[model samples]
Target: MTNHAAGSIPDAANTLVSENGYYGAYGGSFIPEILVPAFAEISRHFEEIRHDGDFWQRYCALLANYSGRPTPLTYADRLTAHFDRAKIYIKREDLNHTGAHKLNNALGQALLAKRMGKTRIIAETGAGQHGVATATVAAKLGLSATIYMGREDMERQYANVFWMKRLGAEVVGVDYGSQTLKDAINETLRDWVSSFETTHYVLGTASGAHPFPAIVAFFQSIIGVETKDQILQAAGRLPDRVYACVGGGSNALGVFQAFFPHDEVGLVGVEAGGQGRDSSNHAARIAYGEGKPGVAQGYRTMFLQNSDGQMKDTYSIAAGLDYVGVSPILADLSEKGRVRFAAATDAEVVEALQLVMKTEGLIPALESTHAFAGAFQDIAESSKSDIFIINMSGRGDKDIFNIAEGLQDEEWKGFIKRKNSQFEDQSR
Candidate 1:
């Protein structure tokens, strides 16, 4: 976690994980033998389609026409004024359809599934945005969809579950283990072991096994492509730093791709600090030594685990960032020092969420608020001329319930109670 000497780490350009799958010994396919052929098939198809101009043409068209491409890079005037230091700009991924950058990968993967002759889609989600996005795309493509979500996450993010079901996808609640993202992932992979013939498991983030990390990063790189052009256009130069919240690392990798070639631009990834770094409940993998190198969820990476190598519990105010392990790419980057990592406590995240909403009039998702919290920490030391770009990964609409419960908003709870009572009375 300390600063490393120049030349000690691999060049960022060369460190990008490619088709071979291993990111400096961090990623590999460790799945069941039955799924090996299916993974190989996916890898081969991805390799071909990634190079096919016509395939990309179709994917890009959907991004532009359906999911809304070129999300804004808005300069935060009030936040700049408040900080009185570096300039602040937000890469407004929250403005995209489905209210997050998840849609970009969803549409791309769903298209790939169709081309591969897949008739059904199976996906796992934590905060449910990925489920909603997958469901939305499945509906558009006329494919049957099933979303696996942890019982706890589904409860906190029921709005997304509602939308997923409304989109005609089947939602299954997994109550095993922690009943959260990790459990959802476990169930989804279990389902994939048997259903890979006709179903494409749209692995939501740049985690999991070999082809998935590569596939997800490939689809997500569009965010960086847009951010690079938008930031250069808006700021007249590359930003001094790029900040993004890191859960499964798709969003951070999405924004980090364009900046990788610009070695001068610093990259920072913020992990969810559930209670505080000092407490045992948080998920600050790098900053707090909460995670160690371990294999879980089909890949080898940093995971919250015990000395016996059993997965440990993790907590985060935002369900999306509550996972036990991170993307192998992120783990490699953290080790190489190509990207520095930070932690935002649950308190800091809430405060940043309120502050951003008040200052910039933007209601960012709770997961994205962690980035704001991390970037805000640098404002005091940053030069006035310095530029910073924060990835607002999603909107806050689906997070209303989670935020209300976290804040213990009695009035909101009372309203929910009354609504439930009314519905119960009518039903009786």
Candidate 2:
């Protein structure tokens, strides 16, 4: 590993990508042969644009004009009393144009695609939010767009599917493997390998190879910048706790960026607990196992893989938060104990969703619910002298129908039948 001064992350950060394109042994492209040139080109061009004022000027202009940036930092009034320890605040990235923090990075990469003179964009999406965001930008930029989604998710996230279609993008549903994010990524990679000459692959998270992880983080760091300023403006001081949900970990990393240098801010990442960590079903990677370096989904990172190196089955009620491996940088941070990681059960996420909608009049995406669940813990444990902030990563409109549908699954049939039988006998 190349050495740099501790805490002095390179100002021109992309230049610091190591020989293997690592951010301290957490990132690298371990892809097939066909993707080398494309990834290398992305890395090289990304480095060139590291400090390009003109590029940023245009980017900033778009954010102002189109995306409504400098998203609000809102206080969660009802949660404050219940948590009792700290004032709870939120960085309302959920209110972004595309409804999640994914757009911040997607738009940034889409801008880069324009700079690269690419005419088409391809992306792999889970929960379909990233695909929708990518397709939205590609439409706005008048570029051709294609999004690959897991076949199962295509059904579960039908609203996002409709959004991508409305934005004039072709959605290819992949049925391979587990029919999930990993499979969608495999399909997108196949397309990238074949069409790299003219297509830009817009990865949605900060977990890919070297340049991608760095680039996505840089773009999404707007969350941190805005949050820091907004929190100070609203609360007159820094928040004591900050929370964000982790999938491939972009949103968490984005929000965590501004606070990394602050020892006082307690950074927490809420991983998906499909059932529970101890149960067979869970997406709780960090809590369940030691995160060793391994390759999956084109980047080498910390994943819950079996002894044979195959990835383990991941489970989460939130499709967007169901990835088996987390971003390598997050793994590093957790390993160093710089950040605290926690798990939130699906039941807890649903409860948090209900609480936010009823009290805050906002419906948060299920993926983001993990943050609220964890922040609730911080709020509950605190003594009302502290402040907690949760990154409300997206609106929950897309998840409402799916979440409701899941509640009516075959598993509930027995309960339904017993309740109906009791009611019928009572009437007789």
Candidate 3:
């Protein structure tokens, strides 16, 4: 690994927000008027504390002492050898505390809530990683935490739900709508409407209305900042192309922000193409479907909607990416050709996950496997000398149960059933 002075890096403040939350024609606060003051408070304090040295000092301290920072940039030697000529590097965000990069923003938001004197934290989660991260930070900071998750998600990601409850968080399951992330978001917003006084909503992703997309991106920028520095030091040059999987675009935007101004570097985001782009089961918002401008879940962005203007159902093997809409910033970037968008089918993602585990001895989250699939395809068509870096957004542990079922591993399922039965009997 190459070593260099970390203090010499350029400040990324200017990259945080170039506009008042609009990343082109998209992104604006379309929330109810009753919630206007809550958004304003978040905007005012975020603007002030973002530049405060003491605030950063505390944030950085937490990152280093608590959640591991400067996560390794691992050169996938074995995996790279599988390709004809391209070099591959994985930004191992899976190694972060709580086994994902979600903690970075979770800690920052929780701290901001503390500064604002909010005693309660509420959030909407899909894969449950964000909820667990939020709950972890809330427990640490002595904040009451409540997480809204879809009933289906709670079952699929029961491991995360269990941890969130163990961490003293109250997990509520929403059975309405698609009974997924979208429904959970609606429930969280409804809760915020009445609890805005004593509670702060820790939105899980970089989507949502004004202030949220920008704020989440600002906090998650740590991933990109370190990636830039680490890659520059290791290779003495930036990678030719950077890849990240876009769920609500938190990890994608996090790693893309630092490279946004670097026109020479290409940024590609992988969306979940569940069955195929042509099938209605996919979540490839920008890649297919009606790419019209609309408003949903408090933000004006491109959504999967019917002709009647109602949001359509979305699906993905990766629960985290199963959403009807994407981040407005991502929508604008994809439209303007600043960032390229690609998609991988669920089958392709599973194959990629298995390939990475076998070749690199590292298991990637199913969500991140989409990026692997896209990057591999891109590398296959590109020049041999090209370098590609993919953001490994999370670990695969949380996905073990779902993956086992997907792979039809009867042995594993039987073992799980036996263990679950024992737990139930003990509880009685």
Pairwise TM-score winner, candidates 2 and 3: 3
What tens-digit string does per-residue lDDT give for candidate 3 at 1-428?
32221233233423534566677788888889999999999999988876787787778778877887878989999988888678899999999899888998899999999999999999999999999999999998999999999999988899999999999999999998889999999999999999999999999998898889887887888889889888887789999999999989999988888888899999999998999967889888887645568998988888888888899888999999999889988988888898899989988898898899999999899998899999987886777678899999999999998888778899998998999999999999
lDDT of 2 at 299: 82
The local lDDT score (0 to 100) that residue 261 gets in candidate 2 is 79
lDDT (Cα, tens digit) per residue for candidate 2, span 1-428 = 11111112223234335777776667777777877888888887887766676776677667767888878888888766554568878788877898888888889899999888899999989998899999999989989999999888887788999999999999999987777787787788888888999999998888776677888887887778778778887889998889999988889988888888789998999999878877767778886564456887778788877788988767788888777788877887887787799989988888887788778888888999889998776565686678788999998888865566545566456765889999999999
Give the TM-scores of the predictions, in the order they appear.
Answer: 0.95, 0.90, 0.95
**Tens digits of per-residue lDDT for model 1, 1-428:** 11111112122322466556789879887888899989988988987886677787677777777777778889999999999999999999998899999998899899999988999999999999999999999999999999999999998999999999999999999988889999998999889888999999999999998888878888888888788778777778999999999999999998998788777999999999999877888777886877899888789999989999999888999999998899899898889888999999988998898889999999999999999999998889999999999999999999998788767899999999999999999999
Task: Please say which candidate is ahead in lDDT: 1 or 2.
Answer: 1
TM-score of 3: 0.95
lDDT of each: 0.88, 0.81, 0.88
TM-score of 2: 0.90
What's the distance in Å from true for residue 130, model 2? 0.5
